[model samples]
Structure formats: C-alpha cells, structure tokens
Target: MTEKLNRFGMGASFVPAETLNEIDLGPLKQLVGEWESVVLTQTDEKGVSKPLASGWNVISVPGVPKFTFEVIPYKENLKFSTVAVHAGNRGPVLNGTQFDQEIFGLFYEQQIVSMCDTDFCNGRGFGKDTVIHAETGLLLYVSNINGGYNIARLGTIPHGNAILALGKSAQANNPGTDFFDVISALGVNLDGSIPAMLGYNDQISGIPQFAEFQQVHPNTFLKSTLDTIIGSGSVTDMTVLSMSTSHPDATGGILNIPFIQSNVTATSMDATFWIENISGGSEPEILQYSQTINLVFPSTGTVTPIIWPHITISTLKRMQPQPETNEPLTLSAQAQSNTPGVPQL
Candidate 1:
C-alpha cells in the first residue's frame, strides 16, 4: 500500500502499489501528443505569394554586412512521450508537517527545418528545408511545497547549451495581453531592419528581397491563427504556462559550453506557451508558443558586447494522442530503492 499525503497533513489515502497507472498529469495532460506546425499562406494584390510559416526565428550573426540579421521561416515537429507518473519527492518535516511532493514528467523532442530556398536570405542559407534546430527536453509537473503548482522545463540544445526554467501555470478563458505585447513590441519586421529594441545605434541593413520576410513579427504568424479562432468563437478552453531562466520564485538559468560562451553566450531565456481547445476546427487542440533567448556577442577591436534577442514562435496542431502502451510501468524498483549519499557500488 502507498500512503498519499495531502498538503494539509490532515489525512492519508492508501492505494495499492500496483495501481501506478492511475496518475494525475495536472495541466500538462494537454501536451501529450505529436504536434506539427500549421503553415499558412497569403497572397497580395500583386500576386506575390508569401508563406506565413508556423515557425519563425530572428537572430543576429556576422557576415559581409558587418552585423547580419536573418529572419528564418521554418517548420517544426514536436513530439512528447510520457516518461513517468507519480515520481515522488521526499520532503522535509518542519516541526510536525510533511511536505512531500510528486511529479508527472513528459519527455519531448523538437526538430525544426528551414523553409527557405537558396539565395533567399543572403547566402547564409540553411539549404532548402534543411534541419536548423533540434532539442530534447523534459517538462515536469510538480506540486509546490507552499501551495499551488509549478512547471519546470529541462532542455538540452545541440548548440552546446542547456537550460532549466521554472514558473507557474494557469488555465484561463483567454490569453492575457502580456503574451502578445512582448513579442509585438520586439519583433523584427521584414523591411530588413532590426527592431528599435535591439539598440543598435548605426543603421543596420540586409532586408531580404522577399516581402514575406519584410512585414511581420515572428509571433504575428501565431496571432493570425489565434485571431481567426477567437473571432470564430471556437475557443472552449485556454491554458497558459510562462517560464523563464530568471523566475523570481525559482533558481533557474542556462549553461553553455566553453566555445559558445566565448562567442555567442546565451545569457537568459523566456518562453510562454498557450494551449487552446477549439470546439470545431481542423484540429481539436492547438498549441502556440513564443520563446526569446538573449545572446551576447563578444566585442572585437572596437565593438562592445552586443545583446541580441533570438526569438522563435509557432502555432502547432496536435496530430496524434499520447503513445498507448498495454504494459504497466515498472515503478517498484525506483520507489523502494534507497542508496546512501556516498554510493558504495
């Protein structure tokens, strides 16, 4: 029998140890599936076609243009698999109360590919539809010792950087303005000029020849979809999870390898995810996320270290439900094992 204690220390509920499948995933249950970006297209009166991709990335790099800025349109596939349920955390007993906690975690893999053709955005081409970014991470659903709940992300990037960010979760009727404002205020337009927020005193140039890359914020792709859904009165439910490397209530940050740290050091990261349930749409569940990473480029002979924002945003539709398995989880070994602080084996 396993005794489940509540935050109040009032009573305990006992259940058979074999019933490990009966788990509460909290709000993270909405993310349990495979998702693919919802790519949209728009054509102007002049008959020029623009691909409003589901994913967009804006970053500053070095090239023939001194400080070269690239706006990348991309497609992404993100898959989440259930890793564990009811992962326990033994808490301390303060005075007379036990502050035990449990976690439900999901492991995710994200792959992003460029949607650009050759010579479209300078010769800094990632090739036609080539893989641009890949990441593996874990999303944890945890119960805070004090009261409510916490959501934490453990992500490993192939760019020699690792991140751990923590924050609270909310289920709301509509997403707050903060989610839209931050991105709109800082997003780079397609005119080939960086946002004023970038704080570059000199005139920065290198606008792509295509109008598709010239007139929208990275998050505008997501907002367009959201606007259509909201206008249609189809949003039945909304869930928002916002996390950051500098969360006030938690200790979280990013770590970079020596090579990356010496050049483009990732200083901080902030991301927000909005999941909505549409009553009648092509897909029942839609996931939208906006992530911004701050990077510092080391100074050369005359230039000072420049802090640039790398932003990625996407709107994804759940393509499939979580993986189904008939075999029960092997929880006993982990639940009953206790090795000393200093391991002998």
Candidate 2:
C-alpha cells in the first residue's frame, strides 16, 4: 500500500491538488482558469496614442503581383481545465529493470475574434467581433525519461492541422531580458521586413488604424508590451515555457489533412509562453505567448514552394481563480475492483 501510494505520489500528507497548486502541473499551474486578451497603447507619428489590440496575427498568401500579406488584430479568450490526474507510461525492461513514467495534463480551449470590421488585403480577415479562430488541445507535464523533454503542447486547430511541440522550462527574475534574447535566438526577427518583401504594404491590409503594427515585425508589438509591464515593476518573477517541433532534442511535428497537405503544408511550429506573477494588483497573474507556424505552398512563378510564416501573439490576464477540485485522484475499493488482479489501490 505504501509503495503504491508513493509511486503515484499519494503520500500520507498528500491531499488533492487544486488548479493552482497541482504538483505535477509545475509551471503550467499558472495557466489554469480563464484568461482574456488585453489592449495596449501604440503611439503614432502624429503623436496621437491609439489602442493596440493585444492579439495580432500576420500571414502571407500567394497572389498576382506578389504574395498578399495580412495583419490582423484580435481579441482572445483562453481557458484551461485540469481534467486528468496521475497517468503513466511503462517503458521496456532492460537488465531486469523497467522504466515507468508519470504524467499530468490540462485541457485548454482558445477562441479568437477580429477586433475591427475593416477588410483585409485579398479579402482575408473577418469583420469586427467576428470569430476568427478556435483551437482545443492538451498541455502535458511529463516526468523525466532519460533526460528527455519534460513539457509538451498538443494542439488541434479546426483548420485541419494538428501540432505536437515538446521542450523544457525554467523560472526567471528578468523575463523582459530573457524574452528578448530568446525571440532573437529563435529566428523570430524583430526587424519587421517581411511585408515589403511580400509586396503588400500597410495600405493593402485595410486596417489603417493598425498600420504601425503592420510596418514592424509582429514581435515588436509583444516586446513593447513586455517593456511596459516590466518597466512598471509590477511583475516580480516569471516562468518561461518554450517548445518547438523542430528542436533537435525533441521529437514531434505537425500533421494536416489531405486537402491541406496538397495545397499548403504546415511544416513546423514553435511557441513560447510566459506566465508572470504580479504583486498587489487587481489581477495577480498574466499570460503571454508568441507562436509561429511555417506554411509551404507551390507558387506559379517559382519552382521552389513559397515559404510563408503565420505568427500570432497575445497578452492575457486571468479572469478568476480556478475552483478547487475535491478529488484529483479517487482511491476506492469499488474503483479498483473493476480491474482483475489489481490489489486494493
């Protein structure tokens, strides 16, 4: 009995873990509950400050004169639920010893909507307050297995694509500095030069109010938001979770349906999430993430498939604390009896 409980991390003093206090969730615990996107401020050349939607998406599509580039600002709602507790995978036996790993997971749903009704270049973006994106997935916390990845994100998009990205995590005191460093190192350039190369300028995107956001690298918007938060000294610590399907150390990639695979293939995906802790504020915590997806499609002029990037970034605040779950793991004789040869567990 003692061994079985300890194996499952149910010690004598162990009590049911709630949303924010789950031991297996690690840094992902901060993500539980509801989150809503924020609105930042952007200053124009005219010295007038305008509202900048916290959610921004930039993508390129094949077009006539050149590829049509699009910049869309949106609002998002992300919610996480702790649906599983105490799962495991049994490894192969070697030299009379087998490796058994423990795992925990949380279910997440993401909904995004356009912030403006303006039309986009080549008729892409939706109208104001229109639902633009919907996604559901699982975030897993895997116990170490021979120095392998400890965290992973499994995402499914209605657009006929599924993503499996794996990586690691760490805590940092200076998230602003760390975020900037990683953004640069990961090839997410802040130069904002892709629009011109694609041939569609700000005027073509149709949202004149967001022209400034379109002119620079989409990440610049995220950097500015971090600067303001860190500059205010409100955030004291942060947990950085970075994952990539293309990372050499990790194993996983993107998959698409037949229709999507034939026209445009989603080759890879990478994302970084910053879970920040704020002191003495109405909102005790905030979550920010930057994600990039590589899309490859055949173009008429070039023999080589055109490689375009789809990037999305957002800053969200926690709406409320997640209610405590009374029993994360149920230990009952009736439950154990269902399985044959299983002792009282």
Candidate 3:
C-alpha cells in the first residue's frame, strides 16, 4: 500500500485551490493534484538521448510532486496562477549558485505556468486586449494568437511516469546583436550611440530595426517537428502553437553571440491539458516538441541556421483522479502578450 501511495503523490490534497482573488482555475482545476514526475532524457554527445543524471539513482531526483493553483493579480480582466514542482529545488548544473533557483525554477523542464481565460477559449490569448467573443457559456476556436503573456506545456506520461516540457518562446522577432550589420544595412538607427544586443529591450525602441521586428511579428511564435515518440507513450494529443522569428534567437542557445541577451527565434510551446481518462488505468502519453529560432553565427566567416530546439519527452500515470469537485483545466497556444518584453506579473 505504501508503494501504491508513492506512485500517487499526496501533496495536492493538502493545498487549497478554492479561489485566488475571486478567480477560478476554470479548466485547469484538475492539475491541483500530486504527480510522479521524472526527467527521463537529455541531449547526449551523439545528439542522442540519455537519462538526465544517469550517474544517480531515480530516488534522488524526487518522484512525487504536488502542484498548487496559485495566482497573481496583474491588471484588470487579467488574473493568473502558478503551478510547478521542486518546491525550492535547483538544477544540478547551477553549481549551488542561485541563478537556476527560485523563479528560475519556472523555466525548468518541469516548472511554472499560468492559466487565464484565453486557455479555455482555444489557445487564443485574452489579456487586457483582444475581444474573445464567448457566448454566455460557449467558446470559439480561432487561428490567430497574440499576447505578450503566453504559455507552452508538454504533458506526457511515459512508462506510467509524467514529464513536463517547456518550449522557450519569442514574443516577437526580437532582433539582438547578430543583426547589427543587418540593422546597419537597413540604414536605420535612432543614433550611433546604441550598441548591439543579444535580446530585446523595450526601452530601446528608438532604433528602426528593433521597432520593425516587433511590428513584423507582433505575437508569440512557434513551430513544431512532431515526428514520433519524443520520449515514450502514445502521444494521445499534441499541438504546436504560434511562431515568430527573433532576429537571431529567442532561446539563449547561441551563447557565442556578440552580446549576452539571446538570439532571434521561432519558439515552440505546449498548450493545455485535462485528464484524458480516469478509469484508474496507466497508459503512457508520448511527448516530443521543439521550436525554431533562426541562428546565425560566424561559421568559417559565413553564417548558417542551427537546429536550435527546446524539446522534452516523458510518460506518466494517474496516481490520483481529479477531485470530484475539481474542474478540468484547458489550454491553447493561440496568442501572445501584446506587451512584449514582459512576462512577469
């Protein structure tokens, strides 16, 4: 019986998700439970996959995780909550420094995310702006997604264990340093005082190249190459939503850039989830996904596109069912936060 209890985490039942500033969790309500999470694989030397810390046993990584439906009141008509694992845990690579700690945990493979009205309305973002034409209690699915605020989640259960993947994003074509020459080629700059960048800075919009990039792709961008099993499971359902090109990269994968920001990118993100079944069965869900952000670097004096992708895969089991009174959560990657360069609320 203890073994069975271990399979199903016990943290969820203890947390209270009844309300946050009078906001309801909506479709995401089911996530208020415990789960057995595992970091199954990481990029290997040959570009293959291997266990995250093969050197260590699975017991050290922490299995059972409980998620709390918490939120922050940002602005009018925009309220949100956070859900993540590791309760103050840090990654192995942090070297004990606080860089990959606290808020940084949200960006981890299994980290934080928010749920608002838009996720329920079919991936279409509904923040301070955007008119979501919902009829009384009806929802319409649209193709256009925009909002500086966005979320991508990969939920999969491999071998009866769950894994969550986060697809780094580019709110818009935030050109950074690599494009200085390109910016110069456009013959546009507020003044010659500005320097090259690795990521976007809203205050520096005086530059033509910077302003134009945002105007060109004014939304969260994403692209997906869903082949087969990213890790394991049947891949019951998966969706890659929204994509925009950063000048060089959205993910900081290109570390060798001139500046310390990040490269332009076409990010990929996972959308939403609800318990697929509750018959007390253990079936795996395949999870594999990534996004594109055109990477340009001095490759032998020339430049080329690197397959820079943020991907994850895993399997999970339903250790616990959604609270009988708990509502299921829904998510869709149909929008980007209009206020670029700001995801903190």
Against the hidden reference, what TM-scores do the models get? 0.75, 0.75, 0.26
Write candidate 1's Cα lDDT for 160-193 as tens digits. 7899888778877644323463352232323435
Q: What is the lDDT of residue 43 in candidate 1?
A: 80
Model 3 TM-score is 0.26
Q: Which stretches of candidate 1 lie over 4 Å from their true place?
A: 1-21, 44-51, 120-122, 146-149, 174-179, 184-210, 213-216, 229-231, 280-282, 298-303, 322-345
Whole-model lDDT values for every prediction: 0.64, 0.65, 0.23
Worst 10 residues of 3 by lDDT: 54-63
lDDT of 1 at 262: 78
Per-residue alpha-carbon lDDT of model 2 for 272-344, expressed as tens digits?
A: 8888887654346778888878777544465456556677889898886656665432211111112111100
Better of 2 and 3 by TM-score: 2
Q: Per-residue alpha-carbon lDDT of model 3 for 268-343, expressed as tens digits? A: 2322222332121233421111222222211122233222212111223323444334432233222344422212
- lDDT score for candidate 3 against the true structure: 0.23
Name the candidate that leads on lDDT: 2
| RMSD (Å) of each candidate, 1 decimal | 9.9, 10.7, 22.6
